[model samples]
Target: MIYNKRLILAHFWLAFALFGVAILLGEWQMFIRSPLHGWLRNADLYYRSVTAHGTVMGYVFPTLVAMGFGYFISEAALGQPLVGRRWAWAGYYMIIVGSVAAVVPVAMGLDSVLYTFYPPMIGNAFYYIGVVLVVVGSWVWVALMGINLYVWKRAHPGAPVPLAMFANVAGAYLWGWTAVGAALELLFQILPVALGFATTINAGLSRVLFSWTLHAIVYFWLMPAYIAFYTIVPRAIGGRLYSDSMARISFALFLVFAMPIGIHHLFADPEVGAGFKVVHSIFTAMVAVPTLLTVFTICASVEIAARLRGGKGLFGWVKALPWANPQMLALALSFVMLGFGGAGGLINMSYQLDSTIHNTQWVTGHFHLIFGGAIVIMYFALAYDLWPHLTGRALLNLRLVHWQLWLWFIGMIVLTFPWHYAGLLGMPRRMAFYDYTAPGMFAEGVSVVMSTIGGAMLVVSAALFLTVLIRNHSAARVDPEPFTFSRAVHEPVSLPWALNGLGLWLGLMIALTITNYGYPIVQLIMTPEGRVPPVFVGGKP
Candidate 1:
């Protein structure tokens, strides 16, 4: 832990810094589009900010945090120093360099294609190259995670790997495979057009390849948060994890179900057939099983903690749990938001229901509720828990931390509820401005007003969160003990190969991905008519 302290700190700080900038960009973008702020509107600038904000928030922040958190887990859970400390640093450099390269073009308005990089709306080649570099850097971390675990297992035979390390490695393995989709899209399709090597691109093929990475990447973002739920939160709240076996099963299920379900994202696209979409949709629903398992497992774990504290009655267990503890509060709130978000997800996953909300403001709202609300709240909890340990200083103010979490929760509800309503009212997403005077816009206009209010609250919440972290980082030392993780109710004595190892699961993920995506990708490549000439609109700055 001591050996890799600087490495972990560097990655985390970079992630939050990007997060801060992105939040401000988000608020600004929303404000400019609102009726209250017409003077701020600039189509070019708005899209540029959108591109930067999405890329930083979606790609940069999550990837860095996951990598840093994985490194810390490897050392702490495995009880060993990181094996490839130097290679880890090299990976960090690649990410840093890649981020700058990518952001430069976006900042200059040369790559306002948004994070999706949907073609034939090609951005500069530098943008694609920069993104590729970031992926390559993460792959290095993935390799390190695999090597570290293999070495540890060889050293200690017939022992169940520490649960936290086991989950972390699972996330790494998931990302390594998941990223191939977009990486291929960039290398073969987008880059060629951006570089003038090709006159046309198969837009359908590009979308298909991206669909490969689109949804699974959410799981990659989510794994660390789930790790916190299973390992950190229970212990922080004074309870043991409900079942070790259930946790392992959840991770395994996520690996198997999450990879092949990306085709669900393409239900609106014509190139993919109905049979494939239905198959993908089934797998998409299957992905929810792990989440359900986690919800049940974590709640049971929390109840145990509450009962341990002498709470009585059916729901009194919830009240008996610690509310003041930021980590505990974060867990409760995250689950609540996840419930709402997950329900929305079920609506989107359904073929018939999705047509109602597809490409509307509701889709954006659903995502924010899940990613920003459910997932990011846990990230805050993680930071709060880790800050003291990493800095060797107690947090400067606990009250501020508590307030920040509540504000984030409240703000998210306010922001997303209106978004969902407006989406249902037939408001389109990604629009720079809406004509409030247009026919049938009364409902949309009202929802926009509500959304603006919520956006304002979120901006305030983001400011408070950053302030707390900055103040806490500079505080004087108080605690001397290192941070600890939760233990399981029944710790494993021995585990099966499937739960304890990756060999079997990784193979399954590959076969499933091929079965799901191989034919569509091949057909796109082989058929000349599927290709369309690339049209580059956002020119180099």
Candidate 2:
């Protein structure tokens, strides 16, 4: 247990380092397009940094955190020791290797194809290998979750899966299915071709396969955050989950629908037919139903807690809610951020609006809202909650932790909102330096200024977070016992086997994917070897 906690903390430190690198790259990318280029004019450096930033933030750091959190939850949930501690350590080592391997190539200026790694835009062989390692490492995490679930079900035959374990296991199941597509691409296309095993790879097939992994990966990123919401939020807010069954329903729906919804990403692509895109787009909307339920249920739980605390009225609950409590503050901010971001997502998924905002700064803005605002805020809350427990000492300064959350929330909105407008104005994305050097660049000067100001604020927010984390580490000398979570609500003695079993959700996911993607993929397989790839240029940015 001691070793695992240390291992988890080590990953947290790596995550912090990766966060710094990711944000620094983001700042530099902004500089690349800045009126004052500020040493960011090198296009290759810009691309490499952007790729590293995206991969590190999107995959590396988040996976580490998720794996660490999963390790802790598995023991708690199953009430059994990890089946093989050696296996867990092996997974950890593989992750470390994968993270370093991926970063080294980017740092050395070898490949900067960005996270998607679409063929024809290929990078150095090591880059692909690095990515494969990361994916493989995550597979280990998934495998562990599977084993945990299997063992729990066998040992406690009639018992419902613990809420925390159920959510994590659902996430694992979804990831396992969705990742297969990307895994196929990496193995057959990117890795082989990058290593000189193939002369030319099918970019279309690669992308089509990658599209399978795209949107579903967001849910994978979000599952742990959701787990925290269902398990931690109620306790922190002095309430109970309104419905464990509702959470089960939500996870089941996400597993079934989220995996196959990636086609919406290809809405503008040509190789994939419009019919498939529509199906996926409709699937996209279906996802909103579960999310809406979650939003309402979570808020309702908070309200109930607030009312019990002597608050009055619909609006009064807001004030009664502990705004200073890091968990409560993060959850509130996450909701607001999701509202704005989720609306942008709906716009993107809309066939009409997608035409206008496709590949624009609006797309970037939307993801930042969802990924950074919603997911990252929960990370902050989790870190804050876990820091004292992990360190066996009280947080160095709870007020600073609260302040950091607010700063991060404010900074994110300020940073992303203007990007949305910029997208609408047809400002391109992923470029190093816009013709900002050209004469009359002053036309969009106001937007640029606002964006730069927002970027600066984000930098400040990042600094504040690091400060709090560092302070907590320094205060770890108190040597208090590791704190454990107690149940926040009474759980029923039994759950329906449908809620307990993996088979039903897995079957539903397969059905949805076939309904949505079977024809598209089959058509591609039958098409001639040489066709103008499925790529589409939807406007410059």
Which candidate gets the maximum lDDT versus the true structure? 1
Q: In model 2, where do residues sit more than 4 Å from their true spots?
A: 1-3, 38-41, 437-443, 476-490, 531-541
TM-score of 1: 0.98
For each candidate in turn, give its C-alpha RMSD to the true structure in angstroms: 1.2, 3.6
TM-score of each: 0.98, 0.93
Worst 10 residues of 2 by lDDT: 532-541
- Write candidate 1's Cα lDDT for 1-541 as tens digits: 4458889989999999999899888888787777666645458888889889888888889999999999999988888899999999999999999999999988888888899997989888888899999999999999999999999999999999999999999999999999999999999999988998888999999999999999999999999999999999999989999999999989988888888999878889999989999999889998999999999999999999999999899997778998888889999899999999999999999988989998999999999999999999999999888877777877867888888899899989988998999899878988777787789987887777777788788788778888987887778978656656789999999999889997888899999999999998898899899889877756632
Each model's total of backbone clashes: 0, 1
Tens-digit lDDT track for model 2 on 224-295?
A: 788888788877877777777888899889999897778788878878877778878888988887788889
How close to the true structure is residue 74 of candidate 1, measured as C-alpha lDDT? 92
How well does model 1 score by local distance difference test? 0.89
